[model samples]
Target: MSSNGTFTENEEAPTYAPSIPVPNVQELVREDPSQVPQRYVRDMEDRPKDTDMSHLSSLIPLIDFSLLLLGNKEELNKLDLACQDWGFFQVVNHGVAKEVLQKMKDVAAEFFELPLEEKNKNAMPSDDIQGYGHIYVISEEQILDWSDALMLAVHPSHYRKLKFWPKSPTGLQEIIEEYSNAIRKFGTELLESFSLIMGMEKEALLGLHKQLIQAYRVNYYPPCSKPDQVLGVSPHSDSSTITILMQDDDVCGLQIKHDDDWVPVNTIPDALVVKVGDVIEMWSNGKYKSIEHRAVVNDERARISYASFLYPHDEVEIEPLIDPKTEQLIYKKVKYGDYLRNSMKTKMEGKAHTHVAKVETLA
Candidate 1:
């Protein structure tokens, strides 16, 4: 089957699928702890360690949704400052039902617990980005993260390939649909709020697109014997307009780069983590920043996180909006599709594709 869950039209049936076989990290660690792959290990400089977290308390701002919903001026100012200065924040009482939130996390964990063969049924094709599989595997020698993920396009319901969706977990489809819809609504509301925070007419930023591109990614990070040596996800900024993350409440592994140190993000119960992506930075004309973040594996417990990425429609032309008061334009106009492709290519290489969109000026 193809990555999109469609049958391939090959003239002759191949002995094996074109995709590489990924071992179940959870199973491997249980069977033989000593057999951990060497490729998962990182160098000394890349390993995670305990550091002084005195300044962390002020780094990540937490905002109250009740205040945002009521249009409280003080809270709105705080939101604007968080976007401008920190580029990351946690939102409480965002209106998503607690039942739905718990079910979303439960379904994700259940799907990953399925047998290896069943899970591999949705394995992504080498050429495609959707379905269950490893990402950023460009070469044989490239280091692999001790993680697995299931990714799918959720918006524009017609774009969904239902065959790739899991069936073993009863009610998985229904819960996921409900959760995605709630997230979509929340995202639109947040975008409008952002417009207000930016001093533009409400919906000024959101009204540019007729349709929004939304995708869901469920990440499963298995416990590693040498947690310090392996990363669950590499350091990189997202390529979307905004990314909403549902972190694992019981386990902590998410961290963001603050200055020269990596500070852990403390998980707040029933709260969602918001991240500013590269596209937003471009649209804001560099007024907002897309910060770099990474995930590390837990030594004893597995970690699961759900992230929904909001993007401009494929054909949308993204550029810095005109501001009469502004002295110069920092970014150039570019098609969303072109930027996405370039971003994917450079993502694994530890380079920010958004840098290419910067316009040069004589010093």
Candidate 2:
């Protein structure tokens, strides 16, 4: 398996097999709502057409020219509304240069193409530091996501030691380092906008910033012999606060659940999809939602994606929305570390996550 999570050769393609059913929305909602919470479910009873994306081209908010170039509270609210209600949206002219975006895609492709022996040298040995290569090996968490990934925890400046990076790219390593730094700057700016919309101090999310860890997962989905028989990754919601994904231009494997229907998220040039994750969902008291999404591979070509995860320090406490009242609190306060541990434990046992509890809660 050459870091693509599957063996690749120019040889004859092997027959494909279907993957067992991945946990889906109806099944999730079928569980006790209090135990397995998702805002999309509760709203579905009163509104029947919430998930339809057929006419979504118009329905999906086209961010205005001004909001795309300049940031404002009102614009942030618009973005937040789309996130809360739609769970996914695309933005263009978002400031990051087109060349920079291409570099990220190219470098990720090059990294995955490296020989397996060289790539494994950078494999993560422990789950703690978010090193590099395949964290899912020991994931012991839900079913394994089919793709192989590289993880980088970049933050606080000091934690970004070169040891955690691969030596192959040589100068390319420096380029990635710069890229991560730039993304952090942009991530903070986006978070600031989100904070303002949530009615919190512009810097309210700053303390949790210390533990701000930036993770990059370079995932490769090899062309499956049986493309329709199996999935590249299963359906799952992100556990962090936010995720910025840069998809390869040629692949059309990304999809998201909308109004009880699955809509394809075709990657657009110069567009980045910002996904709201669990922590932000909880912090917003369900005001903002963490939507479930997945990736599927094609039999014709391989696919790659650069997914960057932004998370708070382990000790940071996740509480209700900044407001005292918001649709009645959906969850109790918990630490990010606790949620991670619970996810790991349940995943190891092959169980779908419900509460995403903090271990300390058990204590």
Q: Name the top TM-score candidate.
A: 1
Q: Please report, in order, the local distance difference test score of every candidate based on alpha carbons.
A: 0.79, 0.61
Q: Which runs in model 1 stand beyond 4 Å of their true positions?
A: 1-24, 349-351, 360-363
* TM-scores for the candidates: 0.90, 0.76
For 210-249, candidate 1 gives per-residue lDDT tens digits of 4677889999998887787888988888888999999988
User: Worst ten-residue run, lDDT, model 1?
Assistant: 10-19
lDDT of 2: 0.61
